[model samples]
Target: METKIREAGTGCGCPGNNAGALSSSTKGCCSPPDDVSGKYAVSCCGPESVTARPAGNQAEKRRLDIEFMYLDLSVCTRCRGTEKNLEEAVSEVARILEAAGFEVKLHKIHVQNEEQALALGFVSSPTIRINGRDIQLDVRESLCESCGDLCGEDVDCRVWVYQGREYTVPPKGMIIDAILREVYGGPAGAVHAPSKMEALPDNLKRFFAARRNKET
Candidate 1:
């Protein structure tokens, strides 16, 4: 499939005729910020998507301050679909908020096992969370058998694919809507909690507990 390149606007600081830099692997894409100073940074990836930091005070005024967590495998087919949906959702939301003078955050949930999946009540791939809450309209049981169908492992799942490429991020409009929902206290959506076993290597139990408490 041919990858499309979208133009960036002045606000994004994109150069003429292009939104941002693209990977040589892909046609052209919006590049992430050179430096991510805070919790997040606004990235001008392409015309389809742009990442930006949440404008705390401004967002509060626009009432669009919320954190979005996306649950998906790093390389699962179905999970990729979910990621695409989320990316579109987030990108849309970002554009909306930007127009409204608001901001949002995009977070990635890397689930490793059934325990973590169960904790977040993930019924399907690419689960979305708003402020640690699940936002999927449907709820189903998660399945993990093998990955042999797609690649190395036996557990395999189908994700969304638009043009043969697994969208690591979503388009613009969806993101804006998500943020709007979160700001108004709609629901943080489903929360993907790391399992006891999936804890970070650098962090011991104590550290994990502390971080978990904060997230909760």
Candidate 2:
């Protein structure tokens, strides 16, 4: 599945690097704000420009990929919470990871509807995948009021079992553990796959279809 990609457009509502007037979407370590660009401009592979450095240093770069997949970050509490917690976890370990020669790259993907979700093998929303593997295994689904508001129907979201308790949102410690494990010889790579794909949950399909229709 391919994640949403936003092209650069003319404007001064951007930050850093291309602070001045620029042609269009300036890809970087992070995406432009939704209000600023309303586009998915950032790439998952860190930033676009890099200083000329030694090849030896490049070899030491342990690229840790992070993908926070969700239906709608603006509304879904679980999705929002998970994304924030994951970002914090990565931030907490970023310095250490860099010291250990690792670079952390995170991407927040918005799954438009059910079709996109299925194509991504997304069992539910607020799905956090590190290095192409879901941190929490065993896919399950449940009704989400937040999603319902957006889709105009009862949409299901994913759940996580943390410290013996089930949570609509994943615990910060869980994300920390996931990243730490990878740093300590965990066999893994980060996410590079596109979010949009051609894939299915029956109710989800209907819900997404309804959403698409409403938007159209």
Candidate 3:
């Protein structure tokens, strides 16, 4: 099967891209910034996904970071399920990514306030990001009864569309599809089973900004 790979991130190392530590470079990548602590500086941050290898290890090891951002995991069943979904997704192809010398790190972030959400560029709760980019960029903010009370009213939670079906929590396959895209970007086609990861929704940034302002 000819796997149609959908590339993720900004292809890395671009002038305008996030300067996270990664081995791969597209145009201009893998340069360490002078400042590592600043928000704009983009440090390796968490141990889950640092590109640097152990000193004297010799063998090249790539860092693959995955983050699952949610509003409040305790109050939201959907968000809780997403955590499991992500685990299953990563487990599906853990060896594939690892064999490619990728040290996989999975994390969960709780966005309790609007400020944190805005700062992190969170489109909605239950959002998943690989590297510094969203897995699926089509962010839908819909009323979630599960977390409505927690939001002080009816909260607009995140939604995902998988296999032509709408789901409150992302399907495991959707995440696997996304990981494959990042795993095999560009001319380096998929070495294993072919999978499809659809592109992000166009012009979603405008909505991200609009949503932030409206809620703030």
User: Each prediction's Cα lDDT score?
Assistant: 0.39, 0.63, 0.59
How big is the positional error of residue 28 in model 3, measured in Å on the Cα after superposition? 37
- Model 1 scores worst on lDDT over the 10 consecutive residues at 9-18
Q: What overall lDDT, based on C-alpha atoms, would model 1 receive against the true structure?
A: 0.39
| Clash count (model 1, backbone only) | 50
Q: Please count the clashing residue pairs in each candidate, in the order shown.
A: 50, 13, 2
Order of models, best TM-score first: 2, 3, 1
Candidate 1 structure quality by residue, lDDT tens digits, 24-113: 343333555544343454446545454564333322222222333333355444456556666676665566556744445555666544
Native-to-model Cα distance after best TM-score fit, residue 144 in candidate 3, in Å:
0.4
* TM-score of every candidate relative to the true structure: 0.38, 0.65, 0.59
Q: Which candidate number maximizes lDDT?
A: 2
RMSD of each: 21.2, 17.8, 16.5
Top TM-score: which candidate number? 2
Off by over 4 Å in 3: 1-58, 186-216
Candidate 2 residue lDDT tens string, 1-216 = 112212211111111111122245664455433233333343445566233322221233556767777777778887888888888888888788877666677877787765456556665567776666677666656677787887788677777777876777788898888778766765333333444434465555766777887799
**Of the pair 1 and 3, which is ahead by lDDT?**
3
Candidate 1: TM-score?
Answer: 0.38
